[model samples]
Target: MKLKSLFVVAFVVLAPATAAKAFPIVRIDAGQLIGRTLDGVDSFKGVPYAGSAAGPMRWRPPQAVRPWRLPRDAGEVGAMCVQPYSPGDPGVGPLPMSEDCLNLNVWTPSERTEPLPVMVWIHGGGYNNGSGTARLYDGANLSRRGVVLVTLNYRLGRLGFFDHPALAAERPEGEPAGNYGLMDMIAALEWVRDNIAAFGGDPEQVTIFGESAGGVAVTQLMVSPRARGLFSKAIVESGMGRQRGVTLAEAEGETLRSTRARGVAWAQDAGVAQTAAALRAAPAAKLLTPAPSIYGGDLVINDGIIVGHDVVTAFEAGEQAPVPLVIGTNSAEFWWIKPGDDTPYGRFDDDMTPEQIDALAQGFGGREGYDAHVISDVIFNEPARHLARMHAKAGLPTFLYRFDVVSEGSTEPHEGATHASERPYVFDNLYSVRWDYERDQRVAKLMAGYWTEFAKFGDPNGEGRLRWPDLRGEVDQLLEFTSDGPVIRAVPNPERLDLVERLYQKAVREGAVAPPAGEVGTPPQRP
Candidate 1:
């Protein structure tokens, strides 16, 4: 996939007006930016909040930006969204990408005057490659622990989940044709609910966090009713709520018109012309080559306009987003599981059979812990304990955690705490990763003080830590963290999350999972 070499460098220079009066401006609603204050925070960098998903706004949805009448300057980090560059792709070495990239990045707390509480961040790759300018998502030490950190940039691979019936008959009539990257994360949470109070933040005290595919986009923006009040709280770390997708009638036959008819037969096998303006003026490295494995998977689409269901039937009908949640996972998550490739003991190539890996390792208790418990209980500890037991059975305030710490210079069978190895200890960003610097800054100050104390008060139990309870009755209990600290256990494998919740209700009673284009009713009116 050709296009890599960009990484520009000189991130906005022109200073000296007394070093631009020591940087820090702010005016938002689209004008004066400036930023950069350092240690006591402030920062800013690459601000655009939307507009320019590139040429005919790629797959639509985002929009707003265009304002700037001078001031500008936000020093660095804005290109990244034109995917495919591997070497474990996240920050450093190869990113400064393009296809316009819809920006965002803040940090705040330069001596705050009030407002405060904000969080945001969504970076995990897998929705196809990451970058909220990834240097372990530097939100200056989580905005020096006061709150107001944000970090954005959406739209990725296939330019953020492509779909096409001629691009859904050229969109416009009720827009939404395949998760335009979850509507660019609800337009960056409606630009953090209308400009995070001119940078003091507190846009209704937001929270939304992320980890793996930004923790499956904070459980798909907590069951997205166009992302409800745009965040009151949510965390999600390894992410998954029984991840489902494919629907515009199962992506119009075996998915997105069979990947846009195999990218128009590989753009007429490279002679480049089966039009849509010749596959939008080709050469995005000849339209990102590597296709067939039945056109690789996930272009996230329950598409009833920005996912109106299927987050486990909108959290088993309690319809989600009643905020306050922290979710978890990662105790050897993916510990490099092998034996079979498509995990969960299912698809293992080279014509399998050792009696089919001993009948899929005798229902997962053998082939020596069947690829680390079916790649850590079917992709992330039973979909984060079934979305924290459906947000503690809808009575909200759920907490749950399990990190299990690793990095003592990890290197064994890929050591423990595998997948995302606890993202630089939940963004206190362990001094940009080499590891064990005083035990990763004391587990990044106890996981950024239980994530800014659950974004200030939605409860992570304050003053002199350790309590963290909440996942209600029948002894569910959670919080584990480890490396010799935060403990309070109990709920770890509940019979393998009740056998992967009966294998996701037998793949939703055999239709191999589908029900949720907003449960077959009204959803079409946001052109």
Candidate 2:
């Protein structure tokens, strides 16, 4: 986003105080807010929905936002969640990162009594990094569409999801505190429920939407009983019910084993092993390095708070909220993984061998593994299909789609639609953006229309426009979003998806893959 000048313009001064003071202004907050332009869209940015999770609160559940002494500054952006990233990742640049990054942003058409539909956004960063401050996430365009838009930042990485047995034992009577990150989201929803009316939004008409790991978080909220009635609808893009977390016993055991193997050696070298407090006090930077697979801290099973788990099973059993859902993925979801032949971001090795390919295929679960690397299947296509099936099985209204739009990169069939390639088209912010500015307008209009329409009503199938079919019956009809135009089709390949589902079923049936801690294997506990 273009950085606005730091000097406070006179127009920014909030009303009701004095001429000497300067504060970001919102047009209305007293009466009914009807359809209005950007001039009347009251915006609040960098609002603290939760307390700063720093110092002793780091790696624990979020605390309540304390009362401010002055009119809190909501014009600026908030701190970003901590995560390790170099400049190599596309659309990602080096910026300040921190643990005290639990904040949110809000946009409303007006603070009138119209009670506009609310859409809350959760960002995707593999459960490690992200903020509500990303430029493309700016809610100005959507707010102009007669809806209230909200974007939030949740705790991530070790600060958000580290689980320990000792920590569980320390919980106060009725308060369970594992899955602190998920709780942060629930807390944010609670805050919105109490305060969104001031921004002209109906707390009852809220829709939760997200991408990637954020999508995964949405799935968790859908299945979580504690999260019941928080959101009335959901949108999951490029992420779905794949892996459920493990149990508290499992998570604590894994932490103990992992720390003892890696952290213990460091602790011993530092001459402290009698207590875990010493390890907790170590510099967060030293502990933030990305470790290989299991030992690296990411979302795992936390038995304490995330009870009655396994999101996939929960959905299948009709345990999730029976709300309308739209889920889909990009065609070239994994294409970006291969940046260039010389690039370190792509490929498992400098040279590709049949043996390595065979190993990879086998590791992905035989035939399903072979299908996973096919751009769309892993990131978008398969997950979208899975969500549809689960929702359909439960007899709920579900819409599935495929984003086939491609740029002029001119690779091969594999380069048609990459992961997150559809974002510009979805938000209509492509004009003022960095990538694909000139080419992303129309698609943006169509997607933003679909999303906003879905928010207004429960359906994207509006009359007098492009017809989007609901997910009904056995046939999987997908709304194809491409540069040519939007059309509905019987997706392209079913056999690949069939193979993938068979593999998933095989893995589930035989217990070949363990659910992430605090999940399918463990029973639910009362909070």
Q: Estimate TM-scores for all models.
A: 0.36, 0.80
**Highest TM-score scorer:** 2
Measured on C-alpha atoms, candidate 2 has an lDDT of 0.64
Q: Where's the lowest-lDDT run of ten residues in candidate 2?
A: 518-527
**Residues 172-235, model 1: lDDT tens digits:** 7876775777789889889889988898988888998888778887887788778888889989
TM-score, cand. 1? 0.36
Clash numbers, per candidate: 2, 20
Worst 10 residues of 1 by lDDT: 517-526
TM-score of 2: 0.80
Clashes of 1: 2
